[model samples]
Target: MASGQVKSAAFVLLLLNLLLYFIVTVMAVWAVNHAIVRSRKTASVLTIPARIFPIYFPVGNMATGFLVIFSLIAGIVGMATSATGYLNVTDGKIQNLHAAAASSLVTLFLTFLAMGLACKEINIGWIDANLRTLEVLVIFVSATQLFCAGAIHARVSEVATILNIYGSGRV
Candidate 1:
């Protein structure tokens, strides 16, 4: 495929990723609103593991959302530079790909942790059915978005490296 088409594909994927993260963030906020904040204090010592680490789920979800936003922004900036013919294998533009990949990796880790915590909570019946469903959706979508971000980063990096080889590092 031509370089222009590749950048456009990345642009579309980035937009889809942005929308997915936005949805996940909204769902997470809704779940947080419904979840109990302090009622776990009076629970018996027999409480499940979910009771022991309730904050991680919500906080992780929020952090994933934030990281995804950064990745999305970085993706857009990278695309803009590529479109303007400013991309280089050994220049500041390469940093954008690295930043996006790093953000996505962190987001993926946090979302996975959140999903595990959500499962614990679900098993113990600590979460409402409706909110549990939404939270699960958020976790799942965020995971997919993070995966795409990683893929885009890899594609851009490979392309940049190949272009460098062809250009003999002169550009």
Candidate 2:
């Protein structure tokens, strides 16, 4: 595709990712808070399960803790990545573009990690509706993040080619 088209696509994807990441972050925070609250003894009888170190979600299986933590990290990183990508795309600067691309790559990896944990949680069975929503969102975010990163990389190559900037550093 042409440079303009690639840039536009990247911008749109970044915007979408930014919004989704915000939602994911909010959900993660809620989940963590809920887990902590639920783990605490509310009554004299103490009916809840034993509280484990770090965190022990009462809703899902063992993978729930890991999934929530990873999702939170990925959400934060994804937000920053999307913002950097949007700036770079708008400014059309090679250095900013490189930064954006690198951040996007990092976000993609984190998203994938969260996605794997989500899948494991799903497989384990016992997740709540909130977790299921997060799982779906993380999966979707991974796909969009992949496309956004690819578009940025493609734009970098296109710019380098047009400017005759070679890896030899002679340009």
Candidate 3:
């Protein structure tokens, strides 16, 4: 594939990842806050359980959403700097790329955990279904981004040399 095409794909994937995570985060916050508000309306006795698994699901979703967003931002920045090869492959950018990859891994794990909790609690509610779909898409896109970023970063010079290109902008 052409370098430009790779970079373009990276940009688009990153954008989609960002948008999906943003939506998921907003929905999660809304769901969580709604529950909290409803809980506050009740005057029931405070039955504090030492191990309440229900709360962790929403919290995990919220955390995953935030991490996914961070990954998306890093991916977008790295891809956009493709034209400036050194800038794209520098320590900061590499860190960003790795951060994104790590975030994706964490998100994938958290997503499955949340889904399992949902299955146990709600038997696949509408919100859970949507979140699951979004989570899968993000996982796929982020994984692709990580693979491409690693290859591009590792052999950027080789690619340019093989193609008989000049200058750092060869990427």
lDDT of 3 by residue, 1-171 (tens): 665554555555545545554554555555446445654433143445613424423323424434334434433443333323333333324445445444444544454454444343334333455456544544554454455445444344344464465533323
Comparing candidate 1 with candidate 3, which one achieves the higher lDDT?
1
lDDT of 2: 0.85
Residue 11: error of model 3 in Å?
0.4
Measured with C-alpha atoms, the lDDT of residue 91 in candidate 2 is 81
- Candidate 1: where are CA atoms >4 Å away? 1-9, 35-92, 168-171
RMSD of 1: 7.8
Give lDDT tens digits, candidate 1, residues 5-65: 5455555555555565555556555444533462344333435764565343333332333
Between candidates 1 and 3, the one scoring higher on TM-score is 1
**Number of the top-ranking candidate, with TM-score as the measure:** 2
Residue 39 Cα positional deviation in candidate 2, in Å, after optimal superposition: 1.0
Off by over 4 Å in 3: 42-170
Residue 48, candidate 1: alpha-carbon lDDT = 79
- Candidate 3's TM-score reads 0.45
Q: All models: lDDT?
A: 0.49, 0.85, 0.44
Residue lDDT tens for model 2, 1-171: 887898888989999999999999999999989887876553224444443345567667889889999999999989988987898878877777788889899999999999999999999998779999999999999999999999989888777786675542311
